[model samples]
Target: MKASAFVLLLISGLPAAAIAQPNTAQGELLRRGELTGSRPSAKAQMQAASRPANHASDPAQQHLLQTDINLAQARAEELPNLYERFMATTRDERRTWTAPQWDAAGEVLARLNQRYEQVRTDLPLDDRLRVRSLQGEFHTLRGARNVKEKLE
Candidate 1:
């Protein structure tokens, strides 16, 4: 039983070491500029877009967009506290949160990012940079959320 347990542990440990090694084939190909994945068909991409076909604004769509804008603005306003809470909760190395909590945090971060993008576009370059720095906390929180989900 003891020998079998040791063998199991050894096998499980091997893949972690493998992950530490660089993939030479991928690295070389990336250096050569060879790439994979199909380019989106223009027609298909157009059809896939959520924007209206007529390019005429629909009231419902406009309302939804406005709501998105509002939510982002609100989040931007309260971003500091949200980040502080997230950090405080996750500060302990042994603390773990459920996937839902992390996912919600990620969603909030994405919303805050959208808000930041919109706000930045309306500001001067210098102000945009400052705002971006302020907004970075949301991105960090979102990343932590994703990490928590994956760890779970």
Candidate 2:
């Protein structure tokens, strides 16, 4: 009974050891060029080394990109304030915003839209879509204001 139990234990452990063992056949295949490792070849490594480094890490380029991003963010932040101010005015006071205030807002919107369009390719998809949505809102607000002005 003791010998039988020992034999059963050894038998159970054998399959696990077999599964854990690395296949020597894989090494043979690699020696014959039938299998490849994940690492790039020497030629590929040399080509990659010869290529120019990414410009994004350069201080001047990074500064310029950051500046543009800041300007875009500032413009985006201003939109909400402008909308709030426009909404705050009474119906009687709507005309007060037309010439100077509304025109300035329109100019800002146009400039922001142009800047966003110019950089859209550089921006991530979500940010590009956000800028487009802002542009649409600007147009909608401008149209509503125009209609109100015409009604008056």
Candidate 3:
């Protein structure tokens, strides 16, 4: 059994670049360290973390929504480079959960921000909260990028 596993590993490692497509968030996380063979687990955590709260109308909530939007846009711009960094440094045996979470978090922030933006503009709470949330995710992604670099 161990020998077969070794063969599988050897096969998977061959010409990795030729076999792989461009690296995206999902791809990077799935192919990295702890996450390599645990995609289902990583995906579930993301869904739970991103679930909407019950009190959408709260002032603080609104502000978070706005913050999330702006941050998402900015992060989206950096995603290409960020993804490259993740792929270069990450090994199949060292998949990082936080790195995958970073991608999921950014996506959730952006979606929430867009949703809140459609509502009436009079509520400062909404805009402020959204932007803050986005910023939080952006920072998270930035940190993840740094970790990936260090690993490299």
* Candidate 1 colliding pairs: none
lDDT of 1 by residue, 40-129 (tens): 345433432432223113332222223222333344444334334433443432136455544444433333343343333345566545
- All-Cα superposition RMSD per candidate: 17.8, 22.2, 16.9
Best TM-score among the predictions, by candidate number:
2
Tens-place lDDT per residue, model 3, 1-152, is: 99999999988888884556322333223211222112435664465356443433433223323322232233333333333333333222134536555454344433333332333133465444544444444555556677787999
TM-score of 1: 0.32
Best by the lDDT measure: 2
For candidate 3, the 10 contiguous residues with the lowest summed lDDT are: 28-37
Clashing residue pairs in all predictions, respectively, total: 0, 0, 26
Candidate 2's C-alpha runs over 4 A off are: 1-96
TM-score of 2: 0.37
How do the residues 1-152 of candidate 2 rate in per-residue lDDT, one tens digit apiece? Answer: 99999999999999998886444222111111111222345554454345332232433222222322232333434433333332333223434555555554443333333333333445566655554554455556656888887998
Clashes of 2: 0
Query: How does each model score on lDDT?
Result: 0.40, 0.42, 0.40
**Cα error of candidate 1 at position 74, Å:** 4.5
